[model samples]
Target: MHLILEQGDLTTVAVDAIVNAANSSLLGGGGVDGAIHAAAGPRLLEACRELRRTTLPDGLPVGEAVATPGFDLPAAWVIHTVGPNRHAGQTDPELLVSCFGRSLDVAADLRARTVAFPAVGAGVYGWAADDVARAGVAAVRSWDDANPGALDEVRFVLFGPAVLAAFEDALASV
Candidate 1:
């Protein structure tokens, strides 16, 4: 599996799928979630609404993922996963790991050859960038090992240089 770190807009990624660090609501909130919803246009929200009415009545639980059409975004699909928030008292590192793992699991089910991810809990959720990088990289690496060549590439599309550096460091360690 090819792992890459790129510093850019997640909405611009032309991958088969891009992972959104969403809240349980599945409805758009701040950070990556809001930006993705905005970029993907109103239809994205409508799709999410349909999901809420159907499968995710309560909301997407932490570490679980569900996919929706990318709408106006460059990606073909948008995979949304709720990360564990430290400020909210969800501090388990494994939950962060599950965010990456389950997103990939969903991508694999969709036959997505390329996927992009943001640092799952590194924003308003208050997760440290380095810790997020470690868990994110490890989960992707572990999934790659278990699934063999299921995915061609998994890119961490960070918005800033610092977080990108952390992901690069984590990749080097792996």
Candidate 2:
């Protein structure tokens, strides 16, 4: 999957899957997590709760991901990836990269052709937008090379101009 840079609403993407910057609880929270939960309807929350009850560990850390259907969004599935909180340091960087990589792997497992990913950890998590962009682009590039044609398109969807610009710069460099 070759990464493509795009600035748009994630809910509107007609991709096979969209990566949601979710919390460890897998429940709705603020930022991209909340938006995705809201758009996906109440069923999404219910699904998360059920999944947590059966499969999720008792005290799992962040950077883990779970997959669910997109109840209302255009994409067929949603990959809920838990990113680190503010000031998490180097661990945050690696976790953030893993978030992207894990989401891609989930998408690939589902045979997704196109996938959209938001800037993981860049909102309430307080990761610098530029750093997130850089790590995300790098992770996607590496994954694409390692698993050629695993996905046809991988889009970086930014919510704002600043994030979009950062992703554009990162994409150019990669």
Candidate 3:
């Protein structure tokens, strides 16, 4: 898989799928989650609500992922995964890796050739950007190694300079 990194809003990226750093509720929250929800419009919320009402009554679990139609957004599908909240006593790096790994799995299962991702757990969730980047890169590398021809591109659509820099550094070492 090709790993691309850039600082931008994930909502506007035109990929086969974009991963949302969602809360377990999967309704809508701040940061990447909020931006994606807003960009995808009301139908996205309805799909999430239906997800909650039918399949995921207790909400999506941290590190696990699910997909929804992107609606008004540029992408065809939105892969939603809940990152571990460090401030909430979830500080495991494996949890962070799981977010990336599972999101990729969902994207591949959807047969999406190109996917975009946010810096999961690196915003309001309280994880350092460096740590998040490192884990994310490592997860992508591992997944790519296991499934070499599964994807055409994996893009990290970051929000700020700091996060982009972290991914740049991590990817450089890869």
Candidate 4:
């Protein structure tokens, strides 16, 4: 996969899938999750509700990813993954890495050529931007190395300058 570090809105990215940094409920919370849910319209929430009813009865676990239709968004699919809550004492970097790797795995299963990702665990979850960037970039790079042609492009669609800079540095080193 060709990794791109971009500072922009995840909702408008033209890709096969956009990975949402969702909560366990998948019912749409704040930050990237809220933005994606809002941009994709009501159908996105409806789909999430259906998933909760059928597949994810308890709720999506941290670091696990599931796919839903993008609805009104530009992407064909919306991949939702719950990141670890650092403030809640979930400080494992492996779980943070899983957020990226599992999302890529889901995208590969969907045969998605391009995917966009937000800075998972970096907002209300209380993870530092630099740490998130390192784990995210490393996870994606590791996956790309393991699965040669799985995806054509994977963009880190950062929301702000600080995170974008962190991701850029991480990308450079990786």
Candidate 5:
């Protein structure tokens, strides 16, 4: 199924899980990470810290995810995935796609039918919104192809109009 697009508060979504655009620390920084952490409450940080201790290399690979309880948010769980940092050609476009791919994989494993995702790598990482949107659409298309009927709903919860426009444009092409 193709992913749905929306601009809203991720904290209020009723999906089974939500994807956070986390940093390497997993401690919660600015943008979506901070918003998720704040909404999920302080316990979320402690849980992340515990997960961090066991899961080495700081963050999971580009196409993988680590999950934690939602704590206080409406969702049941939070799937934290580390996205590529945009810099002088360092960020692979494929890795950007992988971030979405892996997040869905993790959500599927949790038996989640619906998921909400923030625009990955768009804020502090400095990835262009349009590029991120394209990658996200490609990732969701790949996932839907592999697992038909596995995901009932996927929502791209954009933070702003530019991000929403990027996703809309990408979705239009799909």
Candidate 6:
């Protein structure tokens, strides 16, 4: 896989899949999750509701990922993953890394050649942007090394200069 960095709205990224930094409920929360749900329209919520009613009645677990159609968005699929909430005492960096790795796994399962990701566990989750970037970049790089041609491209679609700078540093170092 090819790793790249871009500071932009993840909803508009033209990839096969975009990773949502979702809360456990997966019902549309703030940040990237809300943006994605809003951009994808009502069907996205309905799909999430169906997932909840059927498969994920207990809501999605932290560091795990599940997929739904992208609906009105540019991407073909939306891969939602819950990040560890540091305020809730979920402080392990491994948990944050799992979010990226598992999302990549879902994208690989869907046979997606390209994927975009947000800064999971960052901001409101209480994780530093630098920490999130390091874990995310390392996880993706590790997966790419192990999987080889599984994906053609993976982009860190960050929200601002700070996060983008962190990811850029991680990409260079890790």
For candidate 4, write residues 19-81 as lDDT tens digits: 999999999999999999999999999999999999999999999999999999999999999
Cα RMSDs, all models: 0.6, 1.5, 0.6, 0.6, 1.4, 0.6
Error of 5 at 171 (Å): 0.5
Give one digit per residue, the lDDT tens place, for model 5 in 81-124.
Answer: 88888763547888889889999999999999999999998888
**Which pairs in model 3 have colliding backbones?**
none
Give all TM-scores, in the order shown.
0.99, 0.94, 0.99, 0.99, 0.95, 0.99
- Across 11-92, the per-residue lDDT of candidate 6 in tens digits comes to 9999999999998988999988899999999999999999999999999999999999999999999999999999999999
Q: Which regions of candidate 6 are displaced past 4 Å?
A: none
- Model 4 residue 102 CA deviation (Å) reads 0.5
Give the runs in model 5 whose Cα sits over 4 Å from its true position.
none
lDDT score, candidate 2, position 129: 92
Weakest 10 consecutive residues of candidate 3 by summed lDDT = 1-10
Model 3 CA lDDT for position 76: 99
Note the clash tally of each candidate: 0, 0, 0, 0, 0, 0
Mark the 10 consecutive residues where model 5 has the least summed lDDT: 55-64
Taking all chains together, the TM-score of candidate 1 against the true structure is 0.99
**Of the candidates numbered 2 and 6, which has the greater TM-score value?**
6
